[model samples]
Target: MLKTFRWAFAVTGLGLVAGVLYDGWTALGLVAVLAVLEVSLSFDNAVINAGILKKLNAFWQRIFLTVGILIAVFGMRLLFPVVIVSVTARLSPPQAVHLALTDKARYQELVTDAHPSIAAFGGMFLLMIFLDFVLEDRETKWLGPVERPLARLGRIDMLSVCVALGVLLVTATTFAVHAHQHGGGHADKAQTVLVSGIAGLITYLIVSGLSDFFERRLADEEAGGHAGQHSEDAGTGRPAVALAGRAAFFTFLYLEVLDASFSFDGVIGAFAITNDIVLMALGLGIGAMYVRSLTVYLVRQGTLDDYVYLEHGAHYAIGALALILLVSIRYEINDIVTGLIGVAFISASFSSSVRHNRAARR
Candidate 1:
């Protein structure tokens, strides 16, 4: 209660101070706005995370909040953009850094210009999520036998890799064919886009797949240990440990993936706001904290279970995010607009969930 509030404030304060020191008042304001937008847009994400978190053991929960923070802050915030700049923009590593730091204005323009591709990535990604959800909802008999197979294949996590690859291929071909039309001096631009897209997809696949495998293995071990202890207890009267370790591990992994997915839009969007790398990082980092805290709050409150349609809303948001990303490949999407769209859908779902709960009570 008080302790948690204190901790949250302390963490936020630290982030603000750091942001101010790094980039001053303008940076701080950006951080504040981004934080609000992220939190609002990701309420559904928090609800979904809460449902998963309930299944995890306490140990893994702590790891998720701590280590997961590091990954989000450093990995997604710093490294992700650099990778994008190098791979997509054809800037050498050093040159990219220089552009981000010194030529902040131009760098931001470049990032904004890249939104169509980002939107494309997200749009395709969300489509897979939406399709999978549609197939899984037994109550709504949409696809039947065909639905089941596609549902099985389109498990959002698994299908994301293929979608990403597809996006890369399409982007590569489009860039190659349109290069001359765009005033084609840089022959390597198409190659860079192709390579970067492939790299991003590969990175997503490896990280997500390995995380899933490790979680499954941990779960199996925990199950076996529980069973062994149960048998021993029957003969020797020993208490058995719970077999939920693996579940927790997997939940953590899922949360990480979710975080990564959410951050992609933020990182790209932040660039549109400011090219000052430090400012962009500070602003987005603050936004990350709000999203993280909101996620924890949703878990603590049992928001997902209490609001049944919340998960549905989140999946829907995922669908929208996918669409937004796809569109971004060709247009500049304002973060405010993106955040509002997700928030609106989630809010509607939440209201529906509340109504259903009341009806159930009656």
Candidate 2:
């Protein structure tokens, strides 16, 4: 683990020094706090990434480590918020950068003002992932009491979609009511929220659907038979060879989208610690690197197979996170509360797995 995370440690050390050099001890402290916040909030993200990464080809795995890191650190953490401020505040990208540098308060306000749409979109996308995982009938049952019933309900086609849409509608309506009470006197905010939520749902469907389609094609190519003939081998549960070409491409895209969903909370939450975009990027970017390294480490170590319920824990954490994101649209939730809920669920699942392992040993 030390070897795997050596770069993370190094980068974090450098970031702290740079923070101090850039400002002072206060800046360094804030950067450190932001990094810890990101790491705490995203441990489950690493687990989920490993679950997907293990199925990818080694070449693709390398890309995730290399190219994926760039996207995560620079693309999402730095450029994304700038772009959000640009579009929302009607400024060019360069002007957005200037605003971020010249007027941190205005930049932060713009980003925060855009939070509702971001929350709605990310919430819907993540909700779909959790629902699909729990609602699928799988051979392994981590939390059978909860998962078994959900799996049975998965029989209803597109039930997750229906549930997500219903939830979005209710949430949006609640927001509208609150807006009226506050005298915003406009439905545009609610409209934007609904549209963004639908876009997220659509994005999830496209990415996941394409990934599933390509995975089947690749599996068939390897098995030399009709697609789905070797369904079990297609999943990460079984030993599998690397996917080629198009399959690898789609899988990579899927991973990026998944990472984006996980990042939404971190990006928004970072403002709570400090509104300095550069600091936010530096701190969160350091944590992002660690999360990526953790993903690769988990894949290499085969942690999922050893701790059978770990993936269950990660998925359940995701479910909780999704719910939290949705609820945040209606009420303000502290980032710490979000982090603790995820930790609680994942820790319980881990404990359950340990007990299961001990019993089997006997």
Q: Specify the highest-TM-score model's number.
A: 2
What is the TM-score of candidate 2?
0.92
Query: Which candidate leads the pack in lDDT?
Result: 2
lDDT digits (tens) for residues 203-320 of candidate 2: 9999999999988867666775354455335445443444456777888998999899899999999998888988988899888988989998999999888889888889889988
Off by over 4 Å in 2: 179-184, 225-243
Across residues 220-264, which tens digit of lDDT does each residue of candidate 1 receive? 555766666342224445333332444455557667876777777
* Candidate 1 weakest lDDT stretch, 10 residues: 177-186
Task: Candidate 1: give its CA RMSD in angstroms.
Answer: 5.3
10 residues in a row with least lDDT, candidate 2: 176-185
Query: Distance (Å) between predicted and true CA of 160, model 2?
Result: 1.2
The Cα local distance difference test for each model comes to 0.63, 0.86
Question: In terms of TM-score, how similar is model 1 to the real structure?
Answer: 0.75
lDDT of 2: 0.86
